[model samples]
Target: MGQLQLEEELGKGNYGTVKRVLHKPTNVYMAMKEIRLELDEAKLNGIIMELDILHRAAAPEIVDFYGAFFIESCVYYCMEHMDAGSMDKLEAEGVPEDVLGRIAGAMVRGLKFLKDEMQIIHRDVKPTNVLVNTKGQVKLCDFGVSGQLEKSLAKTNIGCQSYMAPERIKGESTGNLGTYTVSSDVWSLGLAMIEMGLGHYPYPPETYANVFAQLTAIVHGDAPELPEERFSESARDFVSRCLHKLPGSRATYAQLLSHPYLVEDRNRDVDMVGWVKRALESRAEKQVQQQRERNQQVLEQQQQGYQP
Candidate 1:
């Protein structure tokens, strides 16, 4: 159990406080999340399962778990230091529509990677669990509650109430009534994106239960209200598809990447491909300008020395 000097408290959650740490040997910055595993054998098994799932889900858009170790009754996990912070921080700053779409695109890509490539269900896909790097690229984190989908319709009681699918709330004994599957994660993702777009989680109700009730209504009733045509029709359509009550009817991850919203946004509007290309072009042009200046400096030096 190596102890690194904790500089400042980065954030807090149900598990415990995460702090900024300086790895004594490498002198590199990292976020150390201190969590306790005080569970019995069954519960401990669940934690191990989560770790296994995260280990196999090696995606760039998924936060890299550097290492994990235990020290005197507590377990700690080290991860990359996301200097830009979480999506919650971004929401606080009130991101613009273009930026929101970019975030959404990054999130979708990460989820798609998990679902299509790794065959894992995040279970939790809210903004609070999404980390943003300095480049504004979003990565999905927090696999503590995620698991593998056993069937098209699943019955489970894991996940935040606000983001839980309608089927998950039904009686467990009803068996398939809770037939929410990996697509439920997509639903949560859509809701989270909408929250990012609006700068709020869209539950104006008084209590947490009220928030659940509101979500239940939307899940069963009419679609949620829009933001005065703020989102593109394609984006809206993708969201609608994600929130569909029937798990089988929801679009898969591959379908989501090829979705008109993501396709058009990346090809024509603001998105990762366009942003990265522009950044590379800008960097190349700057390098060329610098080279020209350096060549001029060398020529001047040569001319100045020749007269002497």
Candidate 2:
């Protein structure tokens, strides 16, 4: 523990919390996820699945793994550190369609690799799990919930509820309940693309009183689309393809990669490094401004002899 110098806490989830850590001997920086080994099936599955995939999968679209070991009740594993962080932290304003298309292309390629080579389905495919680096690299991370296909179907719902497809939400009332297909991942991809496009969740979570209401809207409501005025026709069509109500109608990874929306920008010379740099700078400046305001308020309160 002492040799692994801890840095800022990246994020935490149901299974584990990821931290930026440095190995003193080699001075290597990596993202280490410290997961508590609870004697439960879900947690056990997550730990085993993540470690298995991370160790075997080697692609530009996937995060690189260093190693993993168990210490006491927690299992700590190291992997790539995405310097620019995840898509959730990126600036949404002025993020044009081309940039988004590039991200989608990379993600699709990553998902394709998992599907074709590893026979795995990433149950969770949200913005937070898609990591981006300052070098213009966008790779998929967090594979704990990923599942191997058995006859092209995984019968479990171990993913984010808000990003679940209508079939996933229903569970099994429709006969295929608990049965999941790759199309379910497509639905999640559409939602993630919108979140990156709009800087927030596509679904109106606030309007709904509860999770069920939000899910009901997802199941029964019309599919979401990017505003015509804000996005191009190709973009709108592409999202529609992924968010189809019927899983069979949804575009597969190969089809989506061939879609004009993604292919058009695949080779375009987008200054991703510059875009990510600017976004990080903007976030840092905003944080500084917020801190300044807070300090000023504190100083004023002290001068006025305010008591709490």
Candidate 3:
């Protein structure tokens, strides 16, 4: 590794900024995430934890952490560069059904790697944390809010508000969050799928006050009304299973990969669902209008007969 020529700023976060850099020696592009370690000791610890976990995870779906160094109080981490950028970018461009299926498969594989293989719980599994490459391959990123579970029951609030599992939001662990389990990640993954397809947070609130109120409701009430039929049937079912309110009811990553919707050609199945739903909705509206028109005609006929 030689001098890295900084080209452009990729992104910025609360604790750090990621910049696109070209290594002069290899002429390869990489992302350099620079974190100011001295800003807050607690924040620094979180970054360090993320770095350590990423290093421990050499799985294919996880972006490789190449190297790291400290310049004064600033910590810089060099990781594999994704040319295609984040899932948010893909969602903005509108992904096709096949591409969405591929993405879903990749994410489930990543979750399997994290949960079964590494035993690391990725508390945050949102779309923004998933990166895509030129080949449309998806990689999981951003471990700042992630934590390794040691017990079977965890009673702490973590992860992004929108992606947080219902139990986690309540800061009450009715399930096994103490140990690194895939259930919590599955819930977040479902939210990620919804966000990617919808182009916004599924449970977005009008204001911050509304957000808290909604989270509280989510913790105690049923899951939000997910716009499932808006996507393919397979995709809808996959996400629906992931969003199951009970953690144990959610599909495991491996189970998701083998799901009929993910592995098979579901063009006919999904399309039929889409077409039929729209037709039924339209027919219902037409029937209502026709009933009103029939009533009006009857009223006019009665009035005309009386007048004659």
Candidate 4:
């Protein structure tokens, strides 16, 4: 790639700071993820692993990789710009069932490809890692914590705690970190689905004061499920199948693809573009309101500080 014109900063992630960039010659917009290798020796391996997976995962359901450039102290990679942004950036008012179904189907397909073709496990499968485009295409991104399966299980205890399966959390409490199977990913899928559906974390971390209590709740309490009366039976059942506490009982990616909820959504005429546009618009409005409230508070504080 030639000289690129940098746009606004996208956001910082575990690996690096992502920024919007324009490829000068091609006039193409790309999300440039810049990773500083000088920060940590382990980052070198993490960057390499992510690059390998991104380079190999050429499926439409996965984020497209453009290229990477490594300087003396850092590496910068360009990837497809997701205009609709991540699923987490959408309005917190909750996602439509149809849109959720679309995202779920796409994510499962991407995960299945990683598992079946490469025997890789996405150790982290949270809402923030799922990306959507204006074209209504949903894809999975960020392979930082992804790892190859060892004896049908991943041993690393990396990833979001709230989305962790009961076995993983319980194992963490003990000396051992539980072996991660594909079903562990399925548990994350259920959590991600519920999070996007409710527009918030299903198990809100702030509600619990003690960290041990939070882990205990995840390990001992009943697994999270969708609101039965609020959602369709098929939708509720699909989430139930994914949230099974016993990893073996959880539905595989293949089984998830065949779920009635996803199947029905697939057959219908969906207006995903409209749904996403509306959500983004709402989010923008909410952000402006929040900014105004912050400014108001600042003015009020200044007024109180004035000496009579």
Candidate 5:
């Protein structure tokens, strides 16, 4: 809009592109998500749903929503710009146990707020949806696929397939994907925690021959857990409570907050700001290295062409 100046593109996904922008009047930096409108009703509904949730979700652990506007065919909504970026980008070398516990606590509190206050379930609970800043605050974002709990269950199987729980995957395979409880999100949280702690997805699809094989493994194989060698007993126990194959046995948001791992985290001082700074520096270095490799490859190709 007239009051905002676009700075740079933050990220792009299937639905839209997010860009860094500055609000002229307020002189504040914000991340603006621009979703192009199409004739598809479902897509429009998703946009509307996200806006609705953003406007209503006012919690410390959730991203702060600014304002939204419609221009031409695109709908742009602004939110708090998390300078440090998402957790997925920072987990390359794996997160420390103390830092992980703090991050997990924020995520659980945010998800709990959505369910209890807004009557919504964050269908997509992954590292990428969790954002952090220099202030050491971790918040949840990207609620486009979030669903309303109907009779303690959400009937839709819409979310990142890789992060889907075993029971949810089984439901999809059998064509009996009627409904999944909130505990499904707990499974995702557990998986995401392991991924953050290990610096990669716990169930790497590359290990399997195909997508079906991977899904089958998730449905039938043992639930993944944090390695005992790397993480403490309390941390492992918290994750185990989340990765339970049976949804009924999984820990609730309240229980997760009360867990000894998180309880201990409350007393300990974790250096999230230092961690984020180092992670960003590492990411920048990796990008530079990748660019150098690409340039070298192009130069080699050029030399080969010249020889002929």
Candidate 6:
């Protein structure tokens, strides 16, 4: 902790905040995740689990962990700083197919590594949790909600409800809890792919009257598919296998890796470096526009106050 210098905050969530940090000795930039300690046993367990996973998860598709230490009431862990930030921060114009395929391959390989090597389930797989860098590398992060698989099933329903699989939703609705399998995460991967390709969530709650209605639809309605007009046949087929109605029918990680879409992508060259640069530029422009709008609103409010 003493060797690290804190910089601007990267993001915040329910568990803690991630910040850009610098190691004084090495002069290397890193992302530091700071989690405040709580008295609850469950919260402590989660923190420990995340630390354990980060320490052991060493792969090209996963973020590189540095070191961790306890400072007062908080635990600070350092990881590789992804300069480009999360995929969710990109513009909503949608990612190019080639870039999308590359991103999908990286995510699938990362998840597969976690499952096969670490015996863990990501539990949360979304654009926000997937980070990218200027080097065009895509890696997974934020493992606070991740859990170890017990006999191929993780019996906890702790993840984003919007990305939950149909079977998981049904279990919650009927009060007949069922074990969560790796297939559930595969379903989430499919939904995330659609969001990245279309620039929005496939199942928008605004279309329904209420939250219950949305969940009902997810549990009983036909699974969403990629639009044929925009996506290739191989891409659509791959996603269809993932978004299968039944959990048992969803494609396994190994199967997905062997799919023609991924196989083709492995051989193709994608300009992810250019895409990431453009995405970051777009994000900066959007932030500037938002700031201008805020300033205008403030000026109008001041004028109204002076008019009296």
- Per residue, candidate 4 scores C-alpha lDDT tens digits across 1-308 of 35899999988874469999999988999999886655455756666776886788888788998989887887888999998899889838778777788888988999999888867778778887899888888988875433321112134332234677887666554646556678988999999999898888877767777666776777778877777666788888999999988889999999999989888988988888898888888889999999999999999999999957
> For this target, which candidate reaches the highest lDDT against the unseen true structure?
5
Off by over 4 Å in 4: 38-46, 144-161, 173-178
- Candidate 5, residue 158: the lDDT equals 28
Ranking the candidates on lDDT from highest down gives 5, 6, 2, 4, 3, 1
The C-alpha TM-scores of every prediction are: 0.75, 0.88, 0.72, 0.90, 0.91, 0.90
Clashes of each: 1, 2, 2, 0, 0, 0
Candidate 3 lDDT over 183-227, as tens digits, reads 878888888777776666666665436555767666666664335
* CA lDDT, every model vs. true structure: 0.68, 0.80, 0.68, 0.80, 0.85, 0.83
Clashing residue pairs, backbone N/CA/C < 3 A, model 3? 151-178, 151-179
Q: Model 5 over residues 1-308: C-alpha lDDT tens digits?
A: 99999999999865579999999999999999887665467766666776887798999999999878888788888999999899888899799899999999999999999999988778778998899998889999976443322112133322223778887777755666564668999999999999999999887867887777777777788998898999999999999999888889999999999999999999998998888888889999999999999999999999999994
lDDT of 1 by residue, 191-246 (tens): 78777777676654554365446656655765453365576676678777777777
lDDT for 193 (candidate 6): 94
- Candidate RMSDs in order: 14.0, 4.0, 13.4, 3.5, 3.4, 3.4
Best candidate per TM-score, number?
A: 5
Q: Predicted candidate 1: what Cα RMSD to the true structure?
A: 14.0
Residue 207 deviation, candidate 6, in Å? 2.6
Candidate 2: where are CA atoms >4 Å away? 1-3, 40-46, 146-161, 172-177, 296-308
Lowest-scoring 10 consecutive residues by lDDT in candidate 1? 149-158
- Tens-digit lDDT string for candidate 6 (1-308): 77889999999865579999999999999999887665467766766777877899999999999978887778788999999998888836788889989999999999999999988788778898899999989999865443322112133323233788888767655665454679999999999999999888777877887777877788788888888999999999999999998899999999999999999999998998998988888888989999999999999999999995
The digit string of per-residue lDDT tens for model 2 on 102-127 reads 89898999999999988878877888
